[model samples]
Target: MLIPKLLWPLLEYEISTSSVESIEAIINTFTRKWLGFPPCQRDVAMYCRKAKLRLPLISIVEEYKCRKARLMTMLEDSDETAVRLFQSHLTINRKWKVCKAVEQEKKALK
Candidate 1:
């Protein structure tokens, strides 16, 4: 969880901008602050995968989900807090991918 002292203002901004992009920018900053120091590329991938899951309305949820699933499978040892936070922050209900009816129909045909 983000510390309240550091998070309240960001939340306030979220309330004002009313844009997922604004919230994502805040999250990217947070991710960089938390995970961008002296870690392996795999670590960055893990964090990014988890972030994509927790973040609402990511345009590429399917991709992130695949990556996260693979990472989760590879990790017998995992951080519970990170997983919980990812699960808790899931914003899927508030967002959806827009698809043309034709596109959806094509997928169904496949």
Candidate 2:
């Protein structure tokens, strides 16, 4: 309910409202505002499910892929710090990939 309202506006205003951080922030805010602190963390999956039921959006997944691509490019271009950063990023990408796969599976059932 609250998520769709806040999120749509952010997507409409930003050229690319796709980052995981951005999406997470919007979700956190929406859940907190509507449901308050108690059970906030527990409600995230339910909120995402509800969002899918209403206005479906896949920008966060796209952004994760784009970020992975960009980080790989960075890794190729540099040494030391950049390589370490890229490895850290790769771990994050693996998590996003799992989440994306789950989302796809859920969508397939619908």
Best candidate (score: lDDT): 2
Q: Give lDDT tens digits, candidate 1, residues 2-101.
A: 3344344533232222354455556555565675544333323433535644423232223333333343333324566566444322233244322232
In order of appearance, the predictions have TM-scores of 0.27, 0.27
Q: State candidate 1's TM-score.
A: 0.27
In the range 1-110, model 2's lDDT, one tens digit per residue, is 54446444533332232355666667556655674556535434543645544324333435445554454455656768746554433434333453354446558989
Query: Which residue pairs of candidate 1 clash?
Result: none
lDDT of 1: 0.40
